[model samples]
Target: MTTATRSTGDDERSAGNDDRPAGRAGARGVLSAYLALTKPRVIELLLITTIPAMFLAERGIPSLLLVLVTLVGGAMAAGSANTLNCVADSDIDAVMDRTKSRPLVSYRVPRTHALVFGVVLSVASFAVLWAGANLLAAALALSATLFYVFIYTLVLKRRTSQNIVWGGAAGCMPVLVGWAAVSGTVEWPAVVMFAVVFLWTPPHFWSLAMKYRADYERAGVPMLPVVATPRQVSARILVYTWATVASTLLLIPVTSWIYVGCAVVIGAAFLVMAQRLHQGVRRGRGVNPMRLFHLSNSYLSVLFLALAVDAAIGLPVLG
Candidate 1:
């Protein structure tokens, strides 16, 4: 009897050990789904604009602790907005090939879980920003979230072809938040930065819309490319691209020569790409919209990186 009991106990322990890996995998899947709901790539772009805004606000490296706090809070706020967007768009996402693999579309995560997670993150974001930065920063972050969820996701997206144009306002809020975190007030430079992002958004997103034209059409979402010809969309993209470059130049009066040099060089490269895109679409060449789309990503990233670098090391022309 004693020998039989020992063998059974050993078998139970072996089974328990075998279940451990499965448990770990399950945990990992849940974490991954939650992260996916946050739209991390978009969050990354938001942060790219954010940290540099802080640098520009201070005209140098801001306090390390303050930067950390603001980033953590900002990330949470963006994540919350994205998660709610996922929830709201899950129906269209399921039908669109590009978004079909999203966590909500795939049913990997339930709606309730995603909703709760977003709310929790939003509350946490407000708490962190208020505690670490200021009430103004916290308010700005929350306003961005509300604008994205209510205006962009709910009203404008389904109602108009100009959805992304107006919807892009939410994305610009990060600069304000970063600036407020540093100076506790919105100022002229911050407004210029906001305009740069706002002007940049139409072209950047329209390029993506051009790439996913069919996807948007299938989902009945009237992205610019869905409602207009590629040539028309490309032309508008070029217009926005030029406006974005001009907006960046607006900062030169307040910034350093390094920033001005970068703005001119980077703006030239961006215009070259945009002009090529326009020429190709107009001529009926099979130009991949993703080429311009990818370039836009680099354009914004490098431009902001120049901003941060100039803030830290370059001499100011105005001062």
Candidate 2:
């Protein structure tokens, strides 16, 4: 009887040892999968717009603590929206080559778990913004998430070719939120920044759509590149590119000489790239949409960086 009991205890100990490693690995995978649901790269881009708007609102850098709080709140809010978007779009994501490797598609995280995780983050985001920033900032952050989930993901994305153009408004909310966080209100400059992003979105996304046209076609997303001919799409891209450049110049009167100079130089480069894409598409030449797509990312980053720099040291250009 004693020997049999010992054998059973030894078997239990062995089972515990075996289960420990599996538990650790499972925990690690769960953590990684949750992080992927946040879409960190997209969060980075969203925070880029938010930070500079804060600087422009403060007319220099805001306090480090404020910056940290706003960034955390913005990230959580964006992550929440992106996570829910993944859940909603999982059906389409399953078929697209580019998206088939997502956490939901791979089934590393269950749908219900991801949904609950997103809800938790969204609530945390609102609480953080309200506690650390203010009511307006929190409201703006929540609105961005709602607009992204409902307006962009559910309502617009699948139905219309002009989906991105209208849907991009949600992406513009970070600038407004940042401005409100610093100043407790939105202003004309914030509106201009919002417009710049709104204009920049189509060309930015269309380039990716152009590269993944077949993916979108397969998914039935009706992206501009999917619905329009290459020349037509490129032409629209050029129009928006020029409009974005012109919108940046509007900042000259509100900002400074440094911002004006940077705007002119960067806008010139952006317009040139757009022109090249348009000409190439028209001529049936080697048109790399990704080139303009990549440049657009650089363009926005540098432009916002310039805004921050000008706010720090630039003299008045309108004088």
Candidate 1 colliding pairs: none
User: Would you list the C-alpha lDDT of every candidate in the order shown?
Assistant: 0.93, 0.92
lDDT per residue as tens, model 2, 88-202: 9999999999999899999999999999989999999999999999999999999999999999999999999999999898888999999999999999999999999999999
Best by lDDT: 1
lDDT of 1 at 128: 100
TM-score, one value per model? 0.95, 0.92
Best by TM-score: 1
Worst 10 residues of 1 by lDDT: 1-10
